[model samples]
Target: MELFFKYLQYEKRYSPHTLTSYHTDLGQFSQYLEQVYQITEPAEADHTIIRSWILTLVQNNIKPRSINRKIACLRSYYRFLLSQQQISVNPMVRIKAPKAPKKLPAFVPEESFNTLLDSFEFEKSFEGQRDRLILEFLYGTGIRLAELIGIEENDIDMRAKTVRVLGKGNKERVVPINDSLLSCIEEYLQYKKSEFSDNNSEKLLVTNKARPLYPKFVYRVVKKYISLITTSDHNSPHVLRHSFATHLLNKGADLNAIKDLLGHSSLAATQVYTHNSIEQLKSVFEKAHPKA
Candidate 1:
């Protein structure tokens, strides 16, 4: 088990959140085996045992999406064990993931976002500047929250107006930035420099005390400001990303271009935004078309 975790962390280069989820899912399954089947090692569990656990999860009212995630974790674990010859047979080969209903990602409207960014009065302090920059940076670049946290001052190339983002699986891509967003970065940099001259943290955004930005802090900042603008359930940094992609699609941007800009490995992942665009088109046709 420890070896498998090490493999995921080092060889697979899985993110911390993914590693934590895998650890938790495996631990839960291991406990279930020990209690029910008197099995100590997960590698000994057969397809039937795996199926039983999944059934138990469904009976416990676990959502299909979460159940599927756990199934994926176990599949990876068993595959690793099989590759290492720790297990003669892979249990996940026969296990199937239950279908989950697809839900569209929630996004903010362009007008609401513009109102938030343009009309919102951010203060003059460093924290205020940092908060505004956080919102603008996420919406402007459409990078993930983790990627934003991983940003270093050197990752941004002002000369080329691009930012190098380390996406999923440690893949790095350069995203272009407009002059307005670039000015926001520069202004925030000036404020950060003056506020934390002695600390000299390489990370682009920092706390009031010059510490690097964390996930919770960023979430709270996003939720606080986003709630004021619109009451969309999607109030996190990812919502801004959805808005960025949806707005671009609504404006007739190419799907492949949006996919590349979003750093998505597949076009299918980027096509979800088109659903929102299609809805917008339906709304326009219904309102403007003379035919009832």
Candidate 2:
């Protein structure tokens, strides 16, 4: 199991966040195997045992999307074992993942974002400046949380008005920045310099203690600020991302262009934002159409 984790870390070059998820999933399965079948190795478990574990998860009301993720982890692990010739055959070959409903990504409305970014005033304190930048950066670049946390001072090219982001699977893409976000970043940097005078961290976003931002910290920041702006049930960094994509699509931005900005591997992943635009069109038609 450790070997498989190392494989994912070094060779597969999976991000720390993704590696942690895989570890957690594999750990749970190993624990299940220990309690149920007394099998120490996940590799030793056959299809019946794996199927039974998945069945129990379903009975426990696990969502199909989450179950599919676990299934994907096992499939990858077994493929690794097969590559090492440690297993004679893949046990996941016969396993079928349940179909998950396709739901549109939740996003903040443009008016909410406009009021937050343009109308409402953020504090003049360093923390306020940083808070504004956090939301603006995510919405501006459409970068993932991990990518935002991993940002270094060197990643931004102020002259080019672009920031380089390392996406999932270690893929790198440069995203353009708007003047608003760029100004926020510049102000935040100046404040950060004064606040952390003794520190010289290269990471773009940091904590009050000058530590690089973590997932939980960023989540709390997003929740706090987003709560002030909108009554939307969703209050995470990804909502800003979805809003970025959705707003762009609504404004008639090209799909391929949005795909490149979002660093998606395929057009299908980017197409989800179009659903929001279609919803917007439906609402407009209901209001403006003369034919009832």
Candidate 3:
């Protein structure tokens, strides 16, 4: 396990968060195997043993998507073992992951977002300004929460009107910013500089005390404001990213361009947004097409 982790850390260049998730998933599976089957070695486990673990997961009411992620962890580990010649046969060869339902990404309506930005009552405090800029930054750049938090002061180029984001797998991409968002960033930076003079932080989004932004803090901030405009129950940071992509597609932006903006490694990953776009197209066609 340590060797595999080192391989992933050094070779795959997985993020710390991703590495932690993989560690937890593997640890959980190992504990389960030991308690249920007295299996001390993962490579010695067979397909039927893996199936029982899957059954246990399902009986515990774990979501299929999450279960699939756990299974992915096992698959990768076993594949590593096989490559190292530590295991003669892969236990996951015939095991299939449970099918997860397809759910469209929830997004705020463009008009609603516009209204929120235009007329929402934000306080005159630094926190309020920071929170407002957070929303606009997420929606404007379509960056993931981690990428946003990972942003440093040096990453922003005011002259170029772009922010360089270090995305998943340590991949870096430059995301363009609009003039409005640029101005908001400028305002927030000025506030940070003046109000938190003792703060030596390099992170772009910091607290009033000039501490780096954490995940839950960002989530709560996004949830608080997004709940005012959206009741879809998914008012998280990623929802703003979805809204950003969906709005772009609706505005006739090329899918490939959107993929680049979102820092998606594959076109297939970005294609999910097309389902939302297709639904929108269907709605318009139903209302406007005269053939009916």
Candidate 4:
């Protein structure tokens, strides 16, 4: 298990969050094996025993998606064992993933996003301008909160209107910036530089006391600004990302283009935005049709 985790971190380049999840999932599976089957080694496991374990998970009312993830973990574990001559056959060969429900991601309305941005008065005040720029960049770029917080000053190119982002798996991609956001970022950088010059902080966004921005701080900033303009309870960086993708899809952007812009690993991941577009189309159809 330790070797597998090392493989995930070093060879596969999985993010810390993904590595952590794999650890929890695999740890649970190992504990179940020890407690139920009295099997401490991977070689002692077989297809029937694995099947019973999955049945137990189902009986416990675990979500199908979560069960599927556990199955994947087990499959990977067995494959590793096979390579090491611990097991000859992979038990998960014929196993099928349970059907998962098609649930759409929640996104804030465009009006609400606009209101959120407008509610911010970006005066020369250090905190005000910093908060406003953070909101602007997140909505404009659709970058993940981690990527945004991890951004260095040199990652942005105002001249080229592009941001060089290091996304999941440490893969780098250049996302374009619009004119308005370009202007905002430029002004914000100037203010940030002047404000933090005495303290020598390299991060793009910081607290009023010249500290690096943390995840909780970013969430609070988003919540505070969004609460002023939106009545929705879900106001976070992820909601902004959803809105960015949904709005692009609504504007007739190509699905592949949206995938590249959002830095998704697969087209299936990007397809979730299609559901939002379909909902919008349904609304337009119901409102415009004369035959009721």
Candidate 5:
């Protein structure tokens, strides 16, 4: 398992969060095998044993999506073992993953989003400036939470009006920044420098005390600001990302261009935004059709 993890880290260049999930899923499966069948080596387990585990998970009311993820983890591990010649047959080769429902990504309405950004008056304090920038950065750039957290001072190219993001799989992509977002970033940086003189942090967004931002803090930041303007039940950094993509598509932006901006590995992932676009078209048609 350790060797396989090292391979994923060094060769596959998987993100730290993805590595953690793989470790947790494999760990849980190992524990289940040891406790239930007294088997310590995953290679010793056959398809029947794996099927039983899946049945157990189903009986325990595990969500289909989560079960599918676990199955994926096992599939990857088994494939690694096969490549290494540790196992002659892959147990997961014939196993079928359970079907999971597809949920449409949630986004804030354009009117409410614009009103919040334009009408609200944030305080002059460094915290206020930083908070407003955090929300705007996510909504404007459509970056993932981890990507935003990983941003450094050098990532922003002020003269070029672009921010370089290190995305999943250690891939780097440059995203364009509008004047409004760039101004906010500049203001936040100035606030950081003037208020926290002794601090030497390079991370773009930080706490009031100049500490680096974390996931929980970012989540709270999104929830608080989004709640103020929109009644959407789902509010998070990803919601802002969805809003970015959906809004762009609504305005006739090309699907492939949005995919590149969003740093998606494939167009399939980007195509989901089209659902929102189609819904918008339906709404317009219903309101404008003369026969109605």
Candidate 6:
């Protein structure tokens, strides 16, 4: 298991959060095996036992995506065992994962996004400037919450008006920034410099004390600010990302272009935004049409 984690960190270059998730999932599976069947080795596992474990997970009300992730972990572990000649066959070869339900991505309407931005008074105070820039950057770039928090000061290119994002698999992509967002970022940086003249932290976003931003902080910021402007129940960094993609799609942006902007590995991953757009269109049609 330690070797597998090393592989994920060094060779696969998965993000630390993802590596942690994989570790947790695999650890739970190992504990289950040990507690239920006294199985201490991957080689001793068989398909029947694997299937039973999955059944138990289902009975416990685990979501299909999570179950599929556990199955993936098992497959990787067993495949590694096979390569080492520790197992004669992979038991997961014939085990099928349950189909994941297609969930529609939630997004704030364009008016709501604008309302949230317009609500920022942009006082010279550090908190005001920082909050404005944080929300602007999230909407403008369509970056994931994790990616946004991981951004370093040097990652932003003022001249090029692009931010270099280190995405999943340690892949890097440059996302262009709008001129308004660029100006906001500039103002925020100036405020940061004035406030933290003695401190030299490199993170793009930081707390009042100049500590780096964490995931929960970002979430709360989004929730608080968005709740003030919009009545929608769904308001988070991811909803901002979804809104970004949906707005672009509504404006006739190329699907592949949107995919690159979102840093999705494949077009399929980015295509969910199209479904949201279609649903919006359908609503419009139903409201406007005079058909009986």
lDDT of 4 by residue, 1-292 (tens): 8888887788878877678778988888778889988888756877888788788889999999889888887777788788877777888896777888877888878887787676656677677788888888889989999889888778888788999998999999999999878888778878777877787777778888888898899999889888877788889988889989999999999999999999999999999899999989999989998972
Cα lDDT tens digits for candidate 6, 61-168:
999999998888788878878877888898989899999998889888898678768765657878888888778988999998888988999999999899998888
Instruction: Let me know the TM-score candidate 3 reaches against the reference structure.
Output: 0.96
> In model 2, what are the clashing residue pairs, if there are any?
none
lDDT for each of the candidates?
A: 0.91, 0.92, 0.91, 0.84, 0.92, 0.88
Instruction: Give the number of colliding residue pairs in candidate 4.
Output: 0
Clashing pairs in 4: none
- Worst lDDT run of 10 residues, candidate 4, spans 116-125
Candidate 3 has an lDDT of 0.91
Better of 2 and 5 by TM-score: 2
Q: How far is candidate 5 from the true structure (C-alpha RMSD, Å)?
A: 1.3
Clashing residue pairs, backbone N/CA/C < 3 A, model 1:
none
Higher-scoring candidate on lDDT, 3 or 6: 3
- The most accurate candidate by lDDT is 5
Clashes of 3: 0
Cα lDDT tens digits for candidate 3, 206-288: 98668899889999999999889777788999999999999999999999999999999899888899999999999999999
lDDT of 6 at 262: 94
All candidates: TM-score: 0.97, 0.97, 0.96, 0.87, 0.96, 0.93
Off by over 4 Å in 3: none
Candidate 6 lDDT score relative to the true structure: 0.88
lDDT of 1 by residue, 1-292 (tens): 8999999988999988799898999999999999999999988899999999999999999999999999999989988988999999888999989999999889998999899899988997788889989998899989999999989999999999999999888899999988878988999888888877787689998888888889999999999999998876679999999989999999999999999989999999998888889999999999999993
Give stretches of model 4 more than 4 Å off.
122-124, 198-201, 207-212, 231-233
